[model samples]
Target chain A: MGPDETAGHYLVANVPRARRGQTVAEVLSQLIAHAHDCMDVVCVLDDDERLVGVLTLAALFALERDRRLGDAVQPGFPKVHATTDQERVASLALHHAISAIPVVDAKGKLLGVVPSAALMHILRREHVEDLHRFAGIARETTLAREAIEAPPLRRLRHRLPWLLLGLAGSMLATLIMSRFEGALAIDPAIAFFVPGLVYLADAIGTQTEAVAVRGLSLSHARMRTIIGGEARTGVLIGLVMGGLTFPAVWLVFGSVHLAVAVAVALVVAGGIATTVGLVLPWLLGRFGSDPAYGSGPMSTIIQDLLTLLTYFVVVSLIVG
Target chain B: MGPDETAGHYLVANVPRARRGQTVAEVLSQLIAHAHDCMDVVCVLDDDERLVGVLTLAALFALERDRRLGDAVQPGFPKVHATTDQERVASLALHHAISAIPVVDAKGKLLGVVPSAALMHILRREHVEDLHRFAGIARETTLAREAIEAPPLRRLRHRLPWLLLGLAGSMLATLIMSRFEGALAIDPAIAFFVPGLVYLADAIGTQTEAVAVRGLSLSHARMRTIIGGEARTGVLIGLVMGGLTFPAVWLVFGSVHLAVAVAVALVVAGGIATTVGLVLPWLLGRFGSDPAYGSGPMSTIIQDLLTLLTYFVVVSLIVG
Candidate 1:
C-alpha cells in the first residue's frame, strides 16, 4: 500500500485495539498514547471478541485527579449487536443520539466494536449501491466487468402468480369498462383517467412501503405501533391527495363521471396501499422472510390489480 | 408513570455518566479505587459543562498503569459534536470500529460519552420495527407519544407531483387504448393479457427494488459488486419464468399471433421492468431524491401506459 493507504489502514486497525481490555487506567493510557498518534476513538469488545461497546478519550479525562481507575468502571451500560445491518445500526444510533455501537452475535456475544466512522462509511457505501440497483444495472457488473446479468428465469417464477391474479382482476376491470362502454363510446374521455387512478393507488402503496421499511428500523417499539402509524399516514396522504387530484381529472377530461371514479379510487387506494405496504413486511417477518423484499414489486403488482378492481367496481356501481 | 412505564423509561435513561473537570489520574484513581462498580466508560467534558470527547475505561486503565497522566490530558483528540446527527456519528464510529464516542457542543466543547451498548439496543429495536413497517403500519401510532414526531404534511408535497404525473400518464394510456379500438373490437382476449403483462413488469420491479433498497444497508463495495449480480439473478428468474409460462400461453391462446405477442411482451416487459426497476433509483438519486421509492405507483402507471402503447402498436402492425 502507498503511504497514505498504509497510514489510514493502520489507523483503522490500531484505534480499535487501543480500546480493548477496557478499564479506566487502561483506557487513559491508550488515549494518552493515541493522543500523540491522533486517533479519535477506540473500540470496546466483549469476551467473544464481538463489538460490545465504545470508549472515547474525553470520557476518560472526567474523573478527579485523585480518582482511582477502578472507580470509573460503572455497571449497567446498554449493549449492541455486532451482526446488525450497519445502516439500520447507524440510523438507530442517530435516533437515540449515540456515538458508538457494540457488535454482538445473535446470541449476544460481543465480537468487536463498530464505531461511528465505520458505520458512516458503510451507510454511504450501501446508499450508493442502492442507487445503482434502483437503476436496474446489475450491481456487481462493475465498470470493470461491463457484463450485465441477463434477467433471471427464476424471477419470472416469483412474478407469474401475482401477474395471473392481476389477469383475473383485469377481467373484472374489463367488466367495469363494458359497463361504461356506452359512455366510453359517447365521449371516450372517461377512459383517459383509468391509468392515473391505478397509478395513484399503486403510488400510495409504494410510499407506504417506503415508510413501513423506515419504521422497521425501530427497536424500542412493537411492529404494530410502527405499522399503524404508517397506515394512518398513508390514509391521510390518500385523503388529501384524492381530494386535490380528482377535480383536476374532471377539468382535464371534462367527465364528472371519470373524476368521481378517479377520486374514489385514489382515496381508497391510499388506505389500501398503505395497509398492504405495512402488512407485507409484518407477514414476511412473521414467516421468517426478509421484510425488505415485501415492499417492492409484489406489493405494487397486487395493489395494481386490487386498485383496478376497486376503481372499476366503484365506477360500475355508480354509473351502471 | 406505572412501574413498567417507569422501568422502561429508566432503561432508556440509564446511560452512564462521568463527572466534569477531572484529570486522567483522578479518574483512574476512582475507577481503580472502585473496580467493583463496573465503570466501563467515561465522559470528558469542558469547563462550560459541554461535552468534547470520550475516554474509555480501558484506555484509562492502560494510561493509569503507565502513569501517563500528562500525555493523556492533551487537547489534540478529535472533539465529538453534540449537535451532530446520531446516525452520522454512529456510522462514523462504526467505520473506525471504536467502542466509545464523545459528544460536544457547537462551540467545540465536550458533552458526554456514548458507549457501544446504546447502539446495539437500538439495532434490535429497529429490526423489529422494520418487520412491522414492511407489513404496512405506522410505528409510532401505538408507541408512546414521545417516541414519534408528528407526521408532517410537508412530505405530501413530494408525493403530489408524482400523482399528478401518474394522472397524465394514465390519460395517455387511455388514449393509447382508444387508438387500439379496432384491435379490441376484433377480440377482447388481447385485453386479458394487458393486466397480466403489467403485473409481470410490476413484480419484477418489486424484486429489483427490494434488492436495491436492502443493498443500502450493506457496504459500498459489497453493494456495487452485488448490483449486477442481483440484476443477473433477476434476469435468470425472468427467463426461467418466461420459459415456463410461454408454452402454456401458446397452448391456451392458440393463435400464433397472440401467442407470439404474449411471449414477446412477457420477455420484453420482464427485461424492461427489471432494468427500469434498477435504473430509476440511480436516476432519482442523481437528482438527490430517495431511490427507495423505486417501486412507486408512478412507475407502474407509466409502465402500464408504455405496455399498453407497445402492445397496441405491435399488434396493430402485425395483425391489423
Candidate 2:
C-alpha cells in the first residue's frame, strides 16, 4: 500500500472477485466463508492471473440478496492500486457512507486496503484542526517538528507584494474614510464600527470561502452543488446574524444611526461575503489552485474594501 | 444522525450487522468465494459470539499470510456499529486498511454492513469542508445537513464574548497605536512597516497555524515533530516571499532604509510567526478546543499587539 511512513498506518481494503466469469454462487460462498478474519481479504483474479476486487462480508450479503446464488458478477465494483493516497481512499469511503471501499489502480488491479480505523482518527483530527485553523489559530504542539523544513517557510515570507496589494486595497478604505470624514467630524461615533464592520465582513467571507474550498477538494463532493446552495444559506444566515448583531451594536456603541448603518452593512456584507466567498473558491478551484489559500487574501481584501465602501454608502443613505 | 437540523431534527443512521464468530477458514472461504458482494456480511465468535473479528477479503488474506489457518481471531479486523457516523465509519475503514468493517450493537451483535465506498464520500466532503472552514469560510449549502452542523459559523456567531475579548486585545494595539502616534509622527517611515511586520508575523503564524491545527486534528500528521520542519519551511517560504516583496516596497517607498526595515520585519516576523504559529495550535488543541477558529482572533490579536510592541522596540534598538 502507498504510505508516507511505516508506523501507524494499517488498512483492509475490499476487492471484488467477479472477474473471469466467476459465478454468483462461487463468489457468495467465498464471501460468506471469509466474513470472519483478522484483516480484510480480497479475491485475486487473472487478466492473465493478476489481481482484481476486494471481497468483504457486507458485499457478499448485498449481492446475495439481489442475485441469489449464481448471478454473473455485475459491474461497478471498485478496483484498487498501491499508489493511491490513504487520505483520498478514506474520503471516498466517507462520502459513500460505506464501512469499507476498494482501492483501485490505473489498470484496474487490486491493491491493499485503507481500513476505517486508520482513517477515522485522522479525519476527526483533521476536522478539529481545520476548525481551529479556519478560526485562525494553532491546535497542538505535541506534533510539532524539532526542525521544520526551510523550503516552504522561505517561499512564504513575502511582505511587499501582499502589503502593497493589501495597501492598495486598504488605501481604498482611506478614500472611503475621507468621503465619510464629515460624518465622523460631526460625530466620531461613525468610525467606531468602521473597523468592526469591516472585520465582521472579513470574518464572514473567510467562513464561506473556507467551506467552499474544502467542499471542492473532495473528488466526490460536487463543486456546483456547493456553489448553488451558498447564496440561499448566506441570506438566511445573514438575516439571523444581522438581526442579532445590530441590536448588539446599538447597545454597545450607543448609536441608533450607526447601528442601523451597521445593520444594513451586515445584511449586504453578509450576502456579499457569502457570494464572494463561494464564488472565489469556485474560481480558484476552476483554476486548479488551492482554493483554500487562493480565496483567503482576495476575499479579505474585497470584503474589507467593499464593507468600508458599503458602510459609507449606507451612512450617506441614512444620515446624509 | 444526531443532528442540528432545525435545532432538533434527526435522521436515523444505517444499522450494520454485528459480528458472529467463525473460524479463520470460514472467513477465508467467503473471500475466495463471493468477493463481489462481501459488504453485507458480518463475522463474530462461533462459541461465546464475542465478535472476535470482522470478516472481509482483505483481512482474511492478511491473516492467512501471517498465520496458519488455526490462529484465533485477534485484533486488526474491521468493526463498526449501526449508530456509527456514516462518515466516520468510512474513514475508519480506510485508515485501518480494511475493506469492510463489521457493525455491532452496544452489546456487540452484528447489525448490517456499510461498505467503504458508501461512508467515505461523506467523510471526504466533511473533511475538505472543515479544512476550508479552517481558513475561516462557511460550508456550502447543497451538501447534506450533517456536513455543516455545529460548524464554524454556529460557533463563531457565538463568539461575541471572544470577539470582545479579542477586541480588548486589539484595543491593546489601538492603545499602542495611540501612544505611539507620537513616535509615528516622528517618523511615519517606522509606521510604514509596523502593519507590514505585524501582518507578516500574522501571515506566517497563519500558515503555521493552518498546518499545525490540521496536523493536530488528524492524528496522522504531527505538529510537534513538524515544528522545526515548519520553521525551516517558513524560512524558505520567507526567503521567497520576502524576496518578492523587498523590491516592491523599495519601488513604492523609494527608500532603501524602508526597504531594509521591511526586510528585517519579514525575517523576524517569519521566524516568530513560525514559532508562535506552531505553539498556539498545540496549546489550543491540548485544551481540547478546535484549534482552527481558536487561533484566528486570539493569535492575531496577540500577534498584532506584540508585533507593534516589537515594532517600537526594534525601532528603539535601531534608532534610539
Candidate 3:
C-alpha cells in the first residue's frame, strides 16, 4: 500500500489495553505477562469492545492496585479518528499535553494508539515541511539532510515551480513600472525607493505571515477580531517605519516632497502588507489547504505589487 | 532560579532508575512500589553512580524476569549534558529516535532525563521560534495566540527591531540605486527589472536559508561539499529562471541588450543568493549563535544588496 498521511498510518495496534472491570493489579499482571509496542498509555475498553477511556502509565502506576480500572480511566481523554491528518494528530497531542493519542474508527471501536515515537516523528516532519513550504519549496523533504544534499536538478525541480510563478508576478511588476515611465522621466529620484519600499513591505508582511501561518489554526478568536487587530498592527508598524524614513530621505536627498511621498507610501504599504498576510493564510485555511501554502512567494509577489502601486500613487500626488 | 533555556531546566530527577546488578523482576517490583515522573526508560547506573546504559520499558517488558538489568541495558543510548540548549536536546532526541534523553553531568553521573513531554514542548516551541526569527521577529512568543493577540504596541516591540534593521538595509539599497542613476538615465527600462530581479534573488536565497538553518546542525557533510552543492543549485535555478525571462523580456520590450542584462544579472544573483544563504547560517553556527539568526531579515538584506549590485553592473555593461 502507498504511504498514507493519516493517524491510521502511525497507529500501533499492539498497545496495552485493559477491560474496565479488571482490577489495577490484574491489569498490571497482564501488562507484565505480555509485550506491547506502546506502554505509555493503556486504552480502556467497554464490554462491547468500544473504547471507553485512557489511563496513562504514570496514573496507572500511582493507582491503588485493588481499585478497578474503570475508576482509574481518564474519561473524555483526547482521541482522533483514523483519517485525521498527521499534523492534527501531533497538534492534538500538544494541545492535550499527552504523549500518546488513541485512534478510533467511525463506529467508536478502538483501533490503536498513535505511539509517542510516532508523535515525535510527526511533529518533526511537519516542522521541516512547514519551513520548506514557507521558503517556497514545492515539495517537502522528510529530512533536513535530504533537503540540502539533494542533487541540484532535484532541488531545482522542487524550487522552480514557485519561482516560475514569482517570475510571472515580477513581469506584472515590470508592466506596472513601464506604465510609470513618464514619472521616472520627470524625476529619476522616485525610482530610488522602489527596492527599499518593496523590501520593507515584504519584510513587514512576512512577519505577519509567520505569525498567521500556524496561528490561524491555533487561534480561536473570531475572524473579524483577528483581522482588526492585525490591520491596526500593520498601520502602527507602517506609521513608525514611515516616520523613521521621512526625515532621513528628506535630509539625504534634500527634498521634502519626496520624503513625504516615501513616508506616506510606507504607512499605506504597511497596512496593506499586514492585511494581505493575515487574510491570505486565513483564506487558504478556509479552503482546506495548509495555511502555509498561502505564504512565501505567492503573498510576497502580491505584497510587492501592492507596495509598488502604493508608492507610485503617493509619489504621483506628492512629487508630481 | 531564573528560567534557564537548558536541558537542566527540563530535567526530571524522579525518573525510573536501577542498579546494574538488579534483575528485571526486581526492578519491575521496585518500579511498581514507587512513582516516577518519567518511566519510558530505566537508567542503569554503576556502583559509582555513573550511568552505564538505558533500558526501554518495551525491552524491559520483553526480557526474562530473571535477567539482570545490565544484560538488558542498551549501552551508549543517546544522552545530553545538563547544560545543553533546549533546542539541541530536542534535536538529539529526534536524531536518536528516543523519546526521553538522559541528561548527565561532566563526570558522567546521570542528573535526570528530559522526559518525552518536555521534548515535545521543546520541538513545538522551537518551531515557532525559528519561524518568527526567519520572518525577522525580534522576540520569540511562546504561544501563537499571544503572537497574534498582543496589543499593537506590544507586537511592534517584538517585531520592530528587525524591521528597523531592515529599514537601514533598505536605505543602503536606496543608496546603491542612487549611484546607478547614470545607468537608469541611459534607459528607463533598466529600472523596470530592478524589483523583479531583486525579488527573484531574494526568493532563491530564502530557499537555501530555510534548508541551511536546520541542515547545518543535522548534516555531517563537509562545509565545502554543502556550499559547492548549493552554489551549483543556485546557478542551475538562475539559468532556468534567466533563460525563461530572456525570451519574455526580448519579445515584450524588443530590447535584446536589456533582456541579456536582466538574464545575466539573474544568473549571477542566483549564485550569490544561494551562497549567502548557506554561508550566513553556517557562520552563525560557527560563532555559537543559532544558525536561524543568520536567516530572516539579516541574510535577506545581504542577498538584496548583492543582487542590486549585480543587476546594476550588468545593466551598466549591457543596457548602458
Candidate 4:
C-alpha cells in the first residue's frame, strides 16, 4: 500500500476518546483536558479499545452533566480502517456530513482520527490534482499557485510528456487519413469536413470524459446505467447538431447527398464519442489508474481517429 | 455580489468565544457548555464582539487551567470580509493552513465563522464546477454523483449548447477548408493532415488553457513573464512535434517539399495554439469571468480553425 493508504499518516493521535460508562461530566472534563486540534467528536471505545460509537461535542454538552457517555453516543457513525485511502477518507467525511473521520485498525481498535484540517487539505489538493491531470500535466503540482509560480523549464518538463504522447497519436491520425486518400480523391469535399467532424466529435467525447472521471469515483449507480445514460445523451446531442447541420450543409454545398452524409456521420460519431469517453475512463479506473488519466489529449486523438474513419465511411456510403 | 460572495452563506454563527480577561478554566467551562457542531476553534471577541484573537481547543487544553485566555490567544490569523468569494475564502483557509476562517464585517466585528465542514464542501463543489464548465456542461451539478445520475434529456439539455456552438464553429471550419479548395486540389495529400494538424494544435492549446486558468487566479507573476513563458513552452513543443513530423511525412510520401509544408505548419500551429490558449483564459479572467470558461470546446474549436488556416496557408506558400 502507498503511504497515503496508511491511516496513521493523516491521523491525529491525541484527540479525546472515551469509554461508554464514563459520566458526561467526567468525560467532558477529560475531553477539555485532553482534546487535540480540531477535536469536534469524541470516539467511544469498547473494553478492547474497539470503536463502538461517536458523540458530537454538541450532543454531549446538551446532555445532563451526570449522564453516561454511552447514552450520548450515536452508533454507526462513519469510521475507516487505518489503511484506507485518503480520498476515501475525505469522501466518507463528506457523505456523513462530518468534519472529521475516525480511523481504526484491522481488529477494529481505535487508531486515531483524521482531523478536519487534514480533510480540508485533502479536498483542495485533490481538486488541483484533477485539474492538472485533465490538462495532461504529468508531474503533480497540487496548487494553482504552484503551477503559476513553477519555473518555465519545470513547466515544460511537466507538460511535455502528454504532448509527446499526443504527437505519436497525431502520427497515427495522419496514417489513418492517408489510408482514406482514395476517398478524398473521389471528392475533396470529404476533406473539407475532416477538421470539423473531428472537432465536434472530440468536443462531445471530452464532456463525457469529464463527467465520467469524477462521477465514476463517487457514483454508486451500476456501470450499465451510467454508460447507457451517457450514450443516450451523446446521441441526443448529435441529433440536434446533425439536424442543424443537414440543412446548412445542403444550402452551402447544393448537394443533398453530401449533406445527408455529414449529418448521418455526426450522429454516428456522437454516439461513438460518448461511448468511447465513458468506456476509456471506466477501463482506466478498473485497472486502478485514475479515470481522469483517460480523459485528455491521448484519448482525444484516439477519438479523433475513430471519428475520422466513421465520417469517411459514411460519406463513401451516402455521397458516393 | 453573488450569494457565494457573502461570508454569511457558509458561516456557522454559534461557537464558543472568549473575553480578553477570562482565565483558561473559565473559558474552557463556557466552551464545553456551549460548544456547537464543529467547534474546533474559539474566537476571542471583545465586549462589542469585535475581533481580538483565536485559541484552538487543543492549545486551550494544554495551557495552565488558571491562565488568562488573552495571553494564550494567537494573533494575525486569516480573516475575510462578508462579501468575499467562497473560492477566495477557501483559498485563504488553505493558504493559512487553518480549518476555520473567521468572517468579520467592515468594523472588525466577528459575524461568524466559516467552519471546516463548509470549507471542505466549498472546495469539492468548486472542483466539480470547474470540471463541468471545462467540459461545457452549463448547469451546475454540485456533486459528481449528481452528474452521473442526471437524466439523459437533462444531460442533453445541459451539454448541447456547447456542441451546437461547436457545430457552428465546425461549419466555419468547413468554409475555411472550402476556401482552400484550390490548394487541396493541387495536392490532395495536404488534406491528409487537416485532422491531425488541428487535433494536435487543439491539444497543445488546451494544456496552456488549463495552466492559465488556474495560474491567473493565484499567481502574483507579471503578465509579461507568464505569457512569455507559455509562448516559449508552446514553441518548444511545436519544434519537437514539427521536427518529428517532417521526417515521417518525408519518408512516407517521399516528397521533401510536401513534408516541409506539413512540418512548418505544425511548428506554426503549435506556436499559435499555446498563445491563443494562454491569452483566451487570461482575457476571460481580466473581464471578470472564470478563466476556465475559455479552456473548453469553444476555445478548442477556435484553435482548430486557426490551425486549419495556418496549415493551408503554410502548405499554399510551400507547395503551391
Best by TM-score: 3
The single-chain TM-score for chain B of candidate 4 is 0.94
Q: Mark the 10 consecutive residues where model 4 chain B has the least summed lDDT.
A: B31-40
**Mind giving the per-residue lDDT tens digits that candidate 3 earns over B118-172?**
8898888878878898888865575777899888888988889899999999999
* B198-313: candidate 1 lDDT, tens digit per residue: 55565556545544443443335444444555556545555655565567656766677776676666556655665565566556656765444423454565556655666667
* Between candidates 3 and 4, the DockQ winner: 3
Off by over 4 Å in 2: A1-26, A29-56, A59-201, A214-271, A286-293, A305-320, B1-56, B59-96, B100-122, B125-129, B132-175, B183-199, B217-251, B254-264, B290-293, B312-320
In Å, residue A298's CA in model 1 sits off its true spot by: 3.4
Q: Each prediction's DockQ? A: 0.13, 0.18, 0.81, 0.71
Deviation (Å) of A149 in candidate 1: 7.2
Candidate 1 off by > 4 Å: A1-54, A69-76, A80-194, A219-232, A240-255, A286-288, B1-149, B152-155, B205-242, B250-254, B274-302
* Model 4 bad stretches (over 4 Å): A35-38, B35-38
Question: TM-score (chain B) for model 3?
Answer: 0.96
Instruction: Please identify which of the two predictions, 1 or 4, would achieve the higher TM-score against the true structure.
Output: 4
Best by lDDT: 3
- Scored on chain A only, each candidate's TM-score is 0.64, 0.63, 0.97, 0.95
The alpha-carbon lDDT assigned to residue A246 of candidate 1 equals 73
**Candidates ranked by TM-score:** 3, 4, 2, 1
Q: Predict model 3's lDDT versus the native.
A: 0.86
The lDDT ranking, best first, is 3, 4, 2, 1
Q: Estimate each model's TM-score.
A: 0.59, 0.60, 0.97, 0.96
Which stretches of candidate 3 lie above 4 Å from their native place? A1-3, B1-3
Worst 10 residues of 4 chain A by lDDT: A32-41
